[model samples]
Target: MSAFIPLSVPNFGEKEAARAAEAITSGWVSTSGARVGEFEQALADYVGMPRAVASNAGSSALHLAAMACGIRPGQEVIVPTLTFIAAVSPLTRYVGAEPVFIGCDDSWCIDPDAVEDFCANHCTLKEDGLYNNKTGAKVAALEVVHVFGNMADMPRLLDIARKYRLTLIEDATEALGTKYVSGPLSGKFAGTMGDVGCYSFNGNKIITTGAGGMLVSNHPDWAEHAKHLSTQAKSDMLQFFHDEVGYNYRMTNVQACLGLAQLERLEDFIATKIARYNQYKDALDGYHGLRILPFKTEAEGVRANHWFYSLYLGETDLDRDTVIAALQEQDIQTRPVWALIHEQADYPRNEAYHLEKAQDLRAHIVNLPCSTNLSEADCARVIDAVKALV
Candidate 1:
């Protein structure tokens, strides 16, 4: 048997292991230590955010952001239906808030027009400057995801958020280095544009701290509040005191050591991923019954991290599962796109507005092997397998 090609995996060099070992040798392998502060500062600088707080995982970052944004019971948050459910799960679990599943466009991000339409048709404003839906429930916030490292239309989404007076939270877990070229936030990174943004350093991400995340915000209060809440809302840091409920969501010093090492090599990782993506594009071009999801560089002036290369099987009777299974049989791992969040049994039965595109992508999209360590030979094997299937 040949080497098994993984869908995505961490690329760790000597620097990462050496840093982890140094942290262990220093006897600061636990959560609280200088490595955590150093990692947070480094990440904040890289993402161009004023401040960032590290957490145990990306999901915890999202949960802390939700709580910090004042998400509460009886309020609604607008979220895309076509993302990993982790993006929406925190909103519901942390605040008892309801998630309104919005549709996605070709970019696999939320449709700004759909967001506006949902707000206009279903929601109205109350005297207290809050948005209330036709069902008389308030819509508190909007959580937009930069799906697969593609930049969502933030300018338009911001307009919609302002019109409805909803808090905007960007789920940039998959888009740590992605940025838009033209707009007020043109030079800004994905997670920095919103009221609060979350990033993941999961094993499969472009950068990894084994399992960690960061929450960043332009607002000082929000950043401070998130830090306070993530550390269990202890008002007095010098004493073991707590004023309100909090969580043990802090990232470990060992993970921070890894994060610092990974951050140093992020640009290289992104470059390698993009190069491989272009290779896949060239190799699979003009194949019938197979369409790669178009990455929009011109419209958004976006430089994506190209985290994962996804292909949309267009106009083919071929089933996605069959393609995935075929690749697995060849020891080349591939996976279908995430299940639509609205389709999950956990979410309430909310109104879905024009979710045709999301449904279509869900049924047909497959993610190919896109790790930074993938060599030219691996790319060729993946392209050959895909071409054979098509």
Candidate 2:
């Protein structure tokens, strides 16, 4: 039997092991180690950001962004229903803001049209900021996630944000290497285009720090504040004095070392991912009802990392569960896209706008094996198994 193929996994080798060993030997394995800053700087340079703040998790980085943005309690953020819950939870649970969920476009990203409609029809621009008429809360921010490494409609989203005084918070946790290849925002990475951006180095992400995240901003103040808040808000070096409420959310030096090593191979990792995605697309073409969702390139003018290749099973006679079961029997792992955030238990009462596309996408998208190290042989085996099952 062949080894089980996972939906997504980290690619680590001797370099990562060596970095870990060095950190262990140096005894600065905690948050205050040199590698932490080195990794942070490396990421900032890679993304074309002025400053970056390292955190324990992507969720924590988002929380820090909200706090640094001065998102007041009872305020609201425009969000997408199609993304992972972490993208929405940080604002609602940690920052005391409300969510107003929007639908996704064909790109499986937050719809710019829906965002405009919501702003024009449902929200009123006031002296202070845009206010949601239904909830009567200031719509302070627009949180856009680059779903499956595909860039969102940033140009239009930026227009709405600027016109309404909404701060753009990019949930770029899944799009580290993704960037616009054309248009006004050409050469800009996913995280750098917004006022603040957050990234994750989780085990299943394109890269891994074991478990770490980073917050970056064009505004130096916001980035600096996020860094200050991440480390327990320590006001003095010698004392445990905290001037404000903060969390112990800083990433460890050990994790940063892993991140440094991983960053070195990011371009190569993206190359492999792209090749694998193309392989899947080429093999599955016209295979009947098994549509491989595209990573928008020419249409969106972006070069995607192709983090996860979505195979929509909606048109097929096979439902997601049946496909999953069949794939599992062959040791090929597959799963449905994330549940719409609005449908989750905690967000029942929050508003979910015309979510037709998101609803369809969530029910049908079967994330295929997209590990960085996945080879042609692995993909062929997966395709064979899927074809055999079908």
Candidate 3:
């Protein structure tokens, strides 16, 4: 029997361990420590944001961003249904904001046209540049996710947000190293383009903080406010002060130590992933009934981190499940894209719009092994197995 080719995992070298050891030895194992502050600064600089706040998890970061953006009960925020539920779940639960689920375009990001149409029909304008919806609650924000490291149509999305006066909160968890190439926002990283951006350091992400996340913004006050709220809204530093209800969402010093180490090798990690992606493209080229999913580089002049490589099974004689089963039979781990969030039992009652592309992709898309540690032999084995199945 051969080794089981796992789908995705973190790549931690000697530096990661050393930094973690230093954090432990320093006795600053909690959230308030030098490692946490340094990690936040390094991430802020890397993403071109003025400030960053580290959090215990990516979902907490999203929740903090939603709160800072003033997402209130019964308000609407546009979100793509084809994303990890963590991106939208926070808004729904923490803020009591209702998500108007949108569809993904070719980039697997939210379609701007759908957003504009939804706003035009459902929302009205306020004097302060906020969009109020038909239900009398303001459309608090627009959550744009950079799906699978692909940049969304930022120009159109930004224009729509501006015209509608919607706050743009970017869920950039999967696009940590992706950068736009053209336009006014050109040369900007994914998370920096929006009003506020959040990142994840989950095990399968491009970088790992052993379960941590960061919230960033060009606006210093927004980042500070998020930090304040994340750290339990304490007013006075001298006393155990409590002003407003807050959360214990801060990231530990130990996690930040790991994050700092991972950040140092981000560029190298991106290069490796891109190389493997190109190899997959070459190997899969001209194979029948399979289309290599496209990244967002061409449209936005952006370079993706290639967090995970997907294949769109186009009119295949074999169903998606069959193809996945075939790959698994060969000890290759391949899985389907995320189930559409609107279809989930928890969000059964949410409003969903123009979800054709998302629905189609969900049924046909397959994600193969894309871990940074995957060797050339592993890549070839996956390619061979996919070819044999097709």
What TM-score fits each model? 0.97, 0.98, 0.96
lDDT of prediction 2:
0.91
- Tens-digit lDDT string for candidate 1 (64-86): 99988888887788899999989
Per-candidate Cα lDDT values, in order, are 0.88, 0.91, 0.87
| Model 3 Cα shift for residue 278 (angstroms) | 0.6
Once model 3 is optimally superposed onto the true structure by TM-score, how far is the C-alpha of residue 228 displaced, in angstroms? 0.9
Writing each residue's lDDT as its tens digit, candidate 2 over 56-139 gives 999999999999998888999999999999999897767788899999999899999999999999999989899999889899
Candidate topping lDDT: 2
- Give a tens-digit lDDT track for model 3, residues 1-390: 879998998999999999999989999999888889999999998987777999999999999998887888887788899999999989766688888799988889999888887888766676865554545666778999999988888888889888878889999999999987676777888888778899999999999987999999767788888999988998998897988999999999999999999999999999989989988988885688677897866455778899999987866776899999888888889899999999886687877888999999999989989998888889999998888877
Worst 10 residues of 1 by lDDT: 126-135
Best by TM-score: 2
CA shift of 104, model 1, Å: 0.1
Kindly give the number of clashing pairs for every candidate.
Answer: 0, 0, 1
**Inter-residue clash pairs, candidate 3:** 181-301
Candidate 2 runs further than 4 Å off: 298-300
